[model samples]
Target: MRTGERRPTLADVAAEAGVSVALVSIVMREAPGASAATRQRVLEVARRLDYQPDSRARLLRSGESRLLGVVFSVRHPFHDDLLTGLYDAADKQGYELTLSAVTPRRDERTAIAGLLQDRCAALILLGPLAPTAELATLADRLPVVVMTRAVRHRAVDVVRTDDSRGLQLAVDHLVELGHRRIAHVDGARWVASADRRQGYRDAMRRHGLEEFVRIIPGGSGEEDGARAARLLLDDPPTAVAVFNDLAATGLLDVLRRHNLDVPGDISVVGYDDSSFSALAHIDLTTVAQDIDTMATLAVSRAVERVAGAQVVHRETVIAPRMVIRGTTGPPR
Candidate 1:
């Protein structure tokens, strides 16, 4: 070696540690087969030589891209909050998340297949629209954790709210306020929406007040709520339980335009206690879902699959609490 020149190599580290070049190579690249003592010795020798492994080579050998694929349906603002929770949890668990939105143009199957080709360990689908049979088929190859959807497949884990109970809470609140002539603004197309709508109907029947209930043609947004409100201009109910906070905001807007008093001349309830639900001006009564817990549990379940654990077909249903605000009162 020249006195003024210096270049580090695996052979140099092997000579310094009294080990073979093969052993030094394993330690330098952090391969799985090295013994702890041998690894420590090789690491010490490399530190003396100031050796750094090639990151590109390391990634190729590990077969891990260190990325988790996350798919969202419709990209609602509430989903943005859930994404924040998911990202924070993923970071703490030492995984990076790649996001893709499923739209009318880009279908779910194509987007998910692209993610799999990129070597993502698992896929998290939020409020998926795919058929249950299709999801079960996908689970045969890779790990799948669904948020806001239910499945009984052995390969899928579900984290969701008790949609039935949430709706019952809404109905019970209005019923307690003497609201017999109540109505429901339903988001009927989604799976969760169907459950909530059924729960509303079931609760109404239990209270023997089904005769007075009205079913409004609505959806999951403020525009749908506004349209439903317009339809109610001629024959308004004493109170209404909207599909979500966005719809409730729209209902409030239409009611304000028509000079109807909230919870006085009419009461209103909404689901999903989103940030917009608590504005100083809005002050909406809503059902609160634990976003942080759901996100954390979802990631943990994904990790269990990645670890080769014998996971069961698990479905978790967390009950929602009703957040009573100024939007509800005794029916007039």
Candidate 2:
């Protein structure tokens, strides 16, 4: 093949192997019509020419793409972990994943549109920001599974950790460690924010520490955590429950810079035991959302819907567990 030339096609393989294009197609698909010897010869010739099948075209022709479109944010560390789990789960179920990222420049609409253009069989959106009405409209078109967020619509299926319960676990853990003055670094108005915030409040009330319940306005990123840390310095709580691992890491950084010893001086707990949280250096005490279970269930749901199965549930809420690490202790 000449440099910069187009890749070899099925026709090229057929011509070289002295077989009809139809025979080549049968061999390529490993269909029953092709004899074993013919299949072996055609495959060998195709290998010699470095011929690669176009999966998209093949799936399109077969009318079963088996493509699960995942819309995730590029910024979240937990999203990366979720993607890894989704890939494994999808592969197990004989499905492929098409990822569309919601970057700073690209909006959710654009990312979702790209997936639609690729003819994805179902959509598995990670922490989607779209409204319920919008999601309902999308569900009407195709099977939609919203992950890491709660939405109630007959058409939409949701698979998410119980955010409120997750936060309650964080607060309870902190309190059990003898932390009376507990502050929450909140993800203001973001998906799952309200539930976490409410969990914090409810846990505080349950512990009879309502007066110590202070919510510092924050967000889902490290910068937001840093900003909240700066505010906490003036009237620091005995312990803090951060929104997620990313924000918790930021808060940890700021606290270290200010010579504050974690747990010793100010115990810190974060939600989402993401891969980063388990790092040797971070060892963040966090709420563990079973990513593997969620991913597997999401794929199963998407596949079942794609195969025209009747799905009764609109939402699947997974329970969150608390992973205690080096970050939490009895506050000084």
Candidate 3:
């Protein structure tokens, strides 16, 4: 509305529709009392007046809100996929998602605080790196579902793919291709990196490739992958399973630059089968998480908790599968 222009209210809509304020409210909220003719009339009059309901105020007055808060990292493309699934899942559960992103300069705490201020009914955190104590503390205040990471806290709900199983799948795929001297690039700085790293170790030992097992430290981005790839130059392994797709892309770039043909010289696999993995040029073989299932479960848990339903299981573990593509082959 323009400055000094009074915003149209239910009183205005009622006056225009030649109905009582109570009847207009009933029509607006789709309550049972309003007849079809009166409902249509009030809607038309409200539209003509460019009237918009203050849903927040209405929800607050009713002592309930259907808003579910989502906290996610801005840098991860996989988070984008989860978000798409989350929106659909929330809609199916009669709720809406409000987003708070964790950027390089913005912390998760700040994002969460904003959601709290908005009076969110529950919180869903994607790949949260918050301390166990802190997460537990948050759960005490409201329903909190932590996604993509397993937390030991009982109060908080967990919806995640088995990170260790994902890494094991990657290693198994490489070993089946006759790759013995397999190496793992670890994302130690990330939330589930430790689990993935341990999985790689367990798989390598199970294959009796213990002597050839190599662990390279990696970080969250493409450069970290590139850095790990550069470190392997002196004694490159027959195959490498990277932490995540973003870092794997960096590793691929470095390998290509050094004239090493992927799958021929060294087979590579990444985690998170992200959006870029299927690109024509970057067809990376990687581990895929069921984003739809995870998102749906997260939303369900949040909604159930908000509705005071009995939560049988606090942690929901989903499986991961390996997507075979051009980046992986029998190492020659």
Candidate 4:
């Protein structure tokens, strides 16, 4: 044996872990294949030896960056959750997720091109506002995944809540509580916005309360909610269902200012059972998105494509469940 030589490689770690070299590779690349027990063993041995995979060397050998580009809306709670889930899933599969914040002013094409310049193998856009055609065009160039948004393009994959159904769940709950006149705080510009609006109208008509439907223009944020509440100050409805919990907080604040009791004089419902919705102070009645399933599926789809597996252009619409909390009650 030579007196001096280079340190051990994945082959060494695999031998030490009693696993295959390919399994060790999967652990480093974050790709799918190995079982959880094998992955843990390989990772433990790699850690004990302070083994660092030469990413540059690996990329050169594999002709893949093994990098996933993630663009999320800044400072958004839902986006934050999506990012956390994306990261966890990507890490488990041995994939590196490189993140960028999509500033409102930047167009989708420009943001995506920047990610491409960084050599990302794929892109995941959180709540994108791009037209379906543009998204389809992007799919032609690379594998792309859209989260919290809908796309009908056969080339791209979408993961989002069934917004129409989520809205119906909100309306039916409010109507069951003897609420005849129920107003809705609308979602902003996007696929979700339009579908949710229709759902609210449909549910109202289904209950034979079409005359009671009122639409208030508001985005999915606390400020928008506050503004919506102020708009209804003069003639507040018996109940209100907001677009999301962020806006619901604003509505609650404004309601408190006007000396109106929630669920007493003006019951309120919110969407997206985000962390804030469950807060002791907020306790908002809201619709819950299946975060774990959405995250897992998004990652799995992306990884499948990256692993040279063909994925059909499709969208996964997970159902939303209504969560009853302190903010809603019988109409007074």
Candidate 5:
């Protein structure tokens, strides 16, 4: 607890509480993701370890102008995961993230404008929906690093997962489970949705399940999955690969409500492997985007550009991995 000694950190508290650093962060920030019991335990661990977050202090000590503005969607659980990593990355580089959230009512423009007003040293956008020209315009003003989405603009640095590969991985897993009547619930019109959709098609064709290729209209939220589930009920597939975990949760809920035993009746797969996927109740088999690598590279690129370093590459694509969980099973 002494000031001169190395201070306890979120990692310390997480280790003590048998939880993840991300969960510790959520507890520390009083975020909504944690359960009340878990929150109490995390708080006790923090108090016991004297763990205090120095991120804000570090930012203030460094300077107000050293902030990295980050634009992300509030609705995406994956964004929350990346935010935790982004904070750690920024902290390592003596910078802090200033976040602008995109809600249902607030558009990306509004989020970006808020960051521009903050006068951050650089901007790192997470799966931004802005057009190439708009991103280019923003890049002309300052360094911009887009994460979790691909862009062709020379001025922008993109750090994203091979989203297509993520879908392919999911499809492959389901196919390996001897599922032929496999369908996909796609991320409709989202920036990364197109690649994910195509990946599904490619994976299905590669497995000679081309005749089984069916795409259900889905989106980035639980509601979208819930709606898609209704359609799926008419003629259910043996397995389904969803666009993302958020949507997958919705689909799971609806399927369960209809007395369908997951994996026994219809196996479900999701992308992003967001924290909730690992929960015992959800236990979603999913494809994981490399959040740590993506965040580190995104921040690294943004910081380098801010430091006036020469751009080496315009984009970085991290690989995806499949997480085998209880949600997936051989066709019944």
Candidate 6:
């Protein structure tokens, strides 16, 4: 090869290995027809020539992308965990993943459009905020699976945690700890916000603590939690059930800044049980969503749809568990 030579191709690899291009293709795809010694020799020559198979060209030839597009929010820690699980699940099913993040500058619509442009075989949305009508329209274009949100759409399959049960567990834990004045920091516009908020109300009523039910305006971010914490300080509750772990951590920081002792002056319970919640210093008592199970189910459903399986468009809800840690105790 000369200086600054063109990148090696499959033909170059075949010529160097004294094999036909057809054999080279078989070796590149790891197809079963090639003998073991011949496959190894071809692979060795390809490696020596720095030859790489063009995945895009192969996908185009097969008319199947085998791509599972994932849309996730960059700000959510739970989304990061879910992404890792999704990758493992997708790989098990012989599919590759293309991720589009919903950042502060990029909205969900833009991220989804980019995935569509990439010709993803199917989409797995992580806690999408798009309207039901919009999702149905997108589903018409390609198979869509919604994760971490419960919605009934004729064209969409859903895989989500039992959010109502999750919040119920949080309130139940606080009630068991003898905390009567329990408030909720709500994720006002989040995907699971309404369900969790209603669950908080229902759980309070179930325990005959409806009279003490309070909900502060919040969302799925630290700033929202900080704002809710300020409101709580005006008339603090003995314990608070936060929207999610990210918001809970913010509230925890604010409470610390105000010299309020957690699980002493005011106990705290968060939802989602994200990675940050398990930190030694955080140790947030929260509701745990089964991320691995949800991810696996989501990928399976998406792959089934992509493969033209005759499956019903149904919602698969997994139960949430309660994790007790340093954050919650009996109310002062």
Clashes of each: 1, 0, 0, 5, 0, 0
Q: Any residue pairs clashing in model 6, and if so which? A: none
Clashing pairs in 5: none
Give candidate 6 misplaced runs (Cα > 4 Å): 1-22, 32-38, 46-57
Give one digit per residue, the lDDT tens place, for model 1 in 115-169: 7876777788888888888998988888889998777776678999898889899
For model 5, give the 10-residue run with minimal summed lDDT.
55-64
Q: Rank the candidate models, highest TM-score first.
A: 2, 6, 3, 5, 4, 1
**lDDT for each residue of candidate 3 in 167-195, tens digit (9 for 90 to 100):** 99999999899999999999978989999
lDDT of 1: 0.84
For all the candidates, what are their Cα RMSDs to the real structure? 7.5, 1.9, 2.9, 7.1, 11.5, 2.8
Which of 2 and 5 is the better model by lDDT? 2
- What local lDDT score does residue 313 receive in model 5, on the 0 to 100 scale? 81
When 2 and 5 are scored with TM-score, the better candidate is: 2
Model 4: lDDT to the true structure: 0.86
**TM-score computed on alpha carbons, candidate 3:** 0.90
Best candidate (score: TM-score): 2
Backbone clash tally (model 3): 0
